[model samples]
Target: MGSDVDFVAYVCEQAGLGGALSYRKMFGEYALYLDERVVALVCDNMLFVKPTTAGRALLDTVEEAPPYPGAKPHWRMDDVLDDGERLGRLLVATAAALPRPKPKGPKVARPGAPRKR
Candidate 1:
């Protein structure tokens, strides 16, 4: 029920990163994605990032929690950002790690193909 477009934009803007980002409704919560791989989410006004193993190791030395209960937490860079450079680096890293998705095209039928009965 919440508008995530703005939230996602805000984060992307603040981080100075951009790409073909989009969103879809999932189980009543909004799931945000960069390219095709999920990147983050806005739940209850708190932003959470997808936990990549590499990203996990980055913060493993510190304690962290999932964005929401009963689910995995976003990459916690909140406490570590004493300046914009650190935050931007974290965002860019995650953005770069995201897998680029192949373009999905519309289904087509062969010529003279029989119609469904």
Candidate 2:
């Protein structure tokens, strides 16, 4: 079953990272971002945080599971949802440990559009 919007909203609310926290719907699920870095995924009403040494160390207990089929295991964080402070800290640490996303190249001009002078 697809993830519910309410669940996604609850997860976001519980994370409590302010403006830096955002989520995008993907394939009927949700991807959680911290400072523009994808730190977790919410699928089937479950939260799957990307595995990082810092995140692992911060968690009270670790459980690994894939957010979707054919994906690498992540730190299943559903149990931590209730504690907003810990969740926020874990997300920040995960984002910090993850590398920055690559910069996108300029978009290609449309075939019918005029080229830059």
What is the lDDT for 12 in model 2? 87
Q: Candidates' lDDT values, in order?
A: 0.60, 0.91
lDDT of residue 11 for candidate 2: 87
* Cα-based lDDT at residue 60, candidate 2: 71
Residue pairs clashing in model 1 are 49-74, 66-73
- Top candidate, metric TM-score: 2
Candidate 1 lDDT (Cα, whole model)?
A: 0.60
Task: List ranges where model 2 is wrong by over 4 Å.
Answer: 109-117
